[model samples]
Target chain A: MSVELDIILSFKDKMFRLAHRITGSYEDAKDIVQESLIRLWKMADKIDKYANPEALAITITKNLSLDWIKSKNNRINKMQIEEYENVLVSKEFSPEKSIEINQLHEMILKLIDSLPAQQKIIFQLRDIEGLTNKEIAEILKVNENIVKINLSRARKKIRELLTKIYNYYEN
Target chain B: MKIEELIEKYFEAETTPEEENILKEYFTSANYDKKLEIYRQYFIFLNSERNIVPGNFLPASILNENSKSKTSFNILSYKWLAIAASFLIIFIIAFTYFKSNVNNAAIVITNENFNEFKDLGTEVTFDAFFKISEYMEYVKSSINDIQAVNETFQILQTYNLMNYQ
Candidate 1:
């Protein structure tokens, strides 16, 4: 396969996974990935314009996911929300394990969601995507310092929420 | 740096990527503090978060469709050709309408007695012209009356000044 084809094949899964996690729905993630792929294909002539293809693809997926969320807000049912929360929580603990793990997962997700949109995106890119701050800064089109600040704020918020949950469980 | 200083630096975003790795390593190691166990769990959650992509069938379908459409069109450039043809038709229609309007306007200007030849009855023209003139004269008279009122007020003020003197 050509370099372009290889890159597409290699990154497709990672891009879709990131989109799925951010969107919290398989259908939305599929749409986001398709949209991102289309965009990448259309801009294939200018492939060199991006410093990092993965970062570019992730940014595209993030934007497409956000647009999907905004457009489908009213259509999102409670069952779907519960299912997505289940997916994230299910990863760490099985149903047989203590419910505390599941509860902790849900609480952490809630805390992450409560963060400002920039901070949330930064957190997802840095921690969940395992991207360097510099890569995130380039993808987000912001200064490196801004990415760092948002990541810090996101981590701090999650830590505080976990502490609160721990205290509650202790009592 | 002290552990507290490191923790503060972490939150303030002053830590380097290497420093961040150190923090993560610190959290996961046996040297971890009890109060900071929650932090450790959070980091583990973040680090272990996996990406889940959909199966190959989806992109394959897209690729198949793209190839099928390409085969159907003898020239891939036909799409743009069709768009150009559509725009050409629209342009022709617009040009015809514009030319016709211009011709109509010119005919209207050239025919000096065109209005007279029109089927409007004498009474309609007489009523329209006379009513419009009457309305204009009414407005003119109202303005003259206001001017006269102002002149009389000025004369009265002059008379009062003479009496005071």
Candidate 2:
């Protein structure tokens, strides 16, 4: 295989996972990954236009996923808010003590879902995907300081939300 | 960095990944202070939630699609060739039909010698009719028969030559 194909194949799964995490829709994520690959393939010969092809693919995936969400929301604007929460929340908890922890996890996820789009993305890339600040910055087309600031703000919000939940359970 | 400064930087969102890793390690350890327990569960949540196993390989069709489109430029070039060939085909067919019809008409007029001139609407004499008809027929036949198509082909060849050069 050519070097471009090799890179695409190696990162395709990671791109899928990133899209899935962002959209919470497996089908949409898969479609976005495929589209991103096709776009990269088309531009492979002129890749000198980009600093990093991997980052370019990632940016494409992110933009496509966000566009999918926008169109989906437009179609299903009447969907109940909790329905979305239920789709995102893990329902694998129904025990005596574990149920409480599960609720906490759900609350955390809800808070994450409530974050501003950029902060949420920053937190997801840095904390969950385990990418470096520089990688996140390049992929998102921002500076490293912006990545740090967004991540910090996202963490602060999660901390505040989780602290509230903890206090509520304790009292 | 010292533990105190690390905690301060952690809350301030200024910690490097290395420092963050150290903090995660310290928080998850059993011997960590109880007052900082809130931070531990948060890290645990981040660690646990990130376990989304990237599920499947890229579909075979995706890779196949790239290979399939490698010949797209060839197809595009053939598109132009097909269009040019079609125009040339139509030109040949039309030209042959028109030239043969003209030749056949010329032969009939020359052989008949104005036998059908009675249908003429003019009140002219036979001599006038015969002379005019014969001269016109001769002019038409010579114009069509004397290498008209050959001259057109030569012009077309020069067009192609100019394009190549």
Best by DockQ: 1
TM-scores for all candidates? 0.57, 0.57
lDDT of 1 at A9: 55
User: Candidate 2 on A1-171: residue-level lDDT in tens?
Assistant: 567677666667667767776676677778888888877777777765677776777788888877877777633323343553454333533432233555566666666665666776778777777778899998888989998888888787776665654564445
TM-score of 1: 0.57
lDDT accuracy of residue B142 in candidate 2 = 83
lDDT by residue (tens digit), candidate 1, B1-165: 766677778777677777777877888689888877667777666655553447873465557656676565756578879889999999999999999897566323236775774655466678898999999999899999999999999999999999998
Docking class of 1: acceptable
Which regions of candidate 1 fall more than 4 Å away from where they truly are? Answer: A45-49, A74-99, B2-4, B29-31, B51-58, B65-165
* Cα misplacement distance, residue B14 of candidate 1 (Å): 2.5
Cα deviation at A17, candidate 1, in Å, is 4.1
